[model samples]
Target: MQMPKRQTDDTVAQAAWLYYVGNLSQQEVSTQLGVSRFKVLRMLADAREQGLVRITVEHRTARALALADRLVTTFGLTEAQVAPVGESNTDDTLARNAVAILASGYLARIAASETPVTVGLGWGRTLSAMADNVTGVRNSALTFVSLMGSVTYASHTAPGDVCVRLAAQTGGRAILLPAPFVTDSAAACDGIMAQRLVREAMGVARSADHAFMSVGECREGSILFQSDIFSADQIQQLRDADVVGDCCGVFYRADGTVADIELNRSTPCVQPADMTRMDTVLLAGGLGKRAATLAVLRAGFVKKLLVDEGLAVALLAEAEKQGK
Candidate 1:
């Protein structure tokens, strides 16, 4: 019985490898693996069920590229990628994942280069999804630095965790900020920044080659409000002050100036000015994030953008409204 089971496992692996990795037809796989076509089909199904095969679909249409070009020219962006929305993709989660897949492909291509590189990371759900999709890169000297303070609880959207995951996926190292995303006071923030390790990691982040981040709106649906990082009152106060969106935990107004709030001083993330020097890519979508995305684009800090069709259309509409 044991021998029979072992033989079956070997046959399954061979059939799967030939069909999936080797790109052989089912008949070819059946013949090469010395199995019937029916057996090959069963083995392929078994491979999928056992998690031996994973498939990803990415749609890049000329229409999407044309939309990206318009965004680039209108906003002075170096590059943009707009994911086409399928008729069935009304759900926000599906749209976010689509943009993340494009972002993952871009990052993977960058990591494939032989040169040493440092990437700065900001925390959000879309950014976390990008880390999940990164594959087939092994950059021994690559480094990922968290550009924001840590979340109190461990989560995939936490800056530290996202940085660690990207480092692991790229076969490199992670540098995390030790302090909270926001301290209670400027003095407390100063105390944390005074630590040698925190200061060193910040220095490295300032010099990083690329910065990848997501924007958040200052409203009920914001991650800042939902994560309990900022109390409802605090978020309401920001909204009252015309804070439209935020990047790297720093709030900003619709006109793109940093919001004049004391909370800015307590944030342990990359400074807004330093962000201009790095090649910044902002990944965000959904109607909830439209205001935030527009604010970031207006600020002119980002060099690249990855967004979905719905968000892209909304952003352009907002821009036209502002122009008139």
Candidate 2:
């Protein structure tokens, strides 16, 4: 009789640590431990079954998970990650950070893939936080491309900045769009887009396998307004045109249709139509963005989403109200 294969406690403990403590997914743990994903899953199950690793789900986390499932089902998204708001549901910064952490984990997993991947990046505080939170990921096969033009002023949340940071973290290359976020006029924008360097960069951005973006609300306190990219009159004009939010420089109305406005024509970036060709992950949070988030989702370009509990609940309620 042959001896049966034995499951070791030491291996189980290492897998648990890598997954639960190190924040690595099963696939990542498998890559690190030189084991199959099935083996890692079995080890994790064994760890839990043996009571060696205690996993507790808080009420807020449980609620967030349920909301995430509803979002995925309602919106037909490939995946939805909702971070628990805890005691600071009203705190936008906290919510953004929580969602960013989840996005960072997702990006890390993508970077760990053996196959080369070109990722397009969009600008926002949450995306900036995601780039900042990425650690210990070094894949030379990765390429980070800016999906939009650079902000006129320096900002960590700018598309170029986020792309560079992600590239640095992953030991990858960064391709920056050599144009402004918004040009002076439509003709100027056309001229810039026609430039060889800008055209090449945009080609890379458009051909990226994966993309990450964030929705910007069309409000006075929005980042676009704060960046001085749009004047008070322009902001009011967007509001007057029923513009609810923007993604990749394409502003949209509450009904998810692109707004026919001067800003939309002048802003040079990846269009919603281009986004439909690739896997796009949208990261957004805060109650202020609830309407904007819904509008972007309705636009039918996002494949995955990462949001906080407050935003998730608001989106679900809004979707039901709209009879979606």
Candidate 3:
């Protein structure tokens, strides 16, 4: 049966918006638009076939898709998404923003679920960009929980801030960990983790249905060093210990083993072991993060990955070299 011309056009447009912009599933769109699932599918196909929806990216789309597929196969990832590199191919911010956009889309789709969900978030510039790009989504059943403690100083990229922004954007709730990212000593960290509020928040984090996190390079110019969360001596010490990068607040070596350092012991964040129990998505980009990204993947914390073209190419090359 055919819908009336005007009604069909309106329905097609609405279905496109709900699926593309709203990030709703086909079933959800069918329910909200008061149509059959098969009809919703047909409308979405019509929308694309008629040029009502257009998807544009700056990089070579075909190459990016192939790279994503290779990454999934080589790394044993459940899924992988690669964003195209900009003209310069050297702009770290642009690469990060591209990857962030992919991450934002992933989160939006997850937020559209009918059942309640708890999402654990980690702190970083990329994650902040993801939070900024998320819009037009309203799901009260979604809850964002900070997987790590807050930065000592004010910063929009802090875990607490990212959680709050995500919660605000989705009309959900934010559960923040009320402790410092790193304490002065292991004893201090232990004491903070014992607090009622901190324990409750951590419990929620550990039980999260899914978790999104970014890796940090264990180097001089990394965010941890720039934020003064770690001093020059500390960075040098980590390097001395062969530390390559960190996920959440736990630093690790090139082989994916957690570094046995005092800094790691004093950091209050959900451990990597806990991440293995949930669906963990690792978002990273920029050419400089190749080593760090590889390290995290080796650590086996990532089930899915979102990255830019340059990084994706580098990772594939690394996998080839290692004969993976």
> Candidates ranked by lDDT, best first?
3, 2, 1
Error of 3 at 157 (Å): 0.6
N/CA/C clash count, model 2:
0
* Model 3 ranges off by over 4 Å: 1-60, 86-88, 231-233
What lDDT does candidate 1 reach at residue 293? 85
RMSD of each: 3.3, 10.7, 9.8
Ten contiguous residues minimizing lDDT sum, candidate 1:
50-59
Candidate topping TM-score: 1
Q: TM-scores across all candidates?
A: 0.87, 0.80, 0.80
Candidate 1: tens digits of C-alpha lDDT, residues 57-120: 5667787878888888878899999889752356789888888988888888788778888999
Cα lDDT listed for each candidate: 0.84, 0.87, 0.88
lDDT of 1: 0.84
For model 1, the stretches where C-alpha displacement exceeds 4 angstroms are 1-16, 24-59
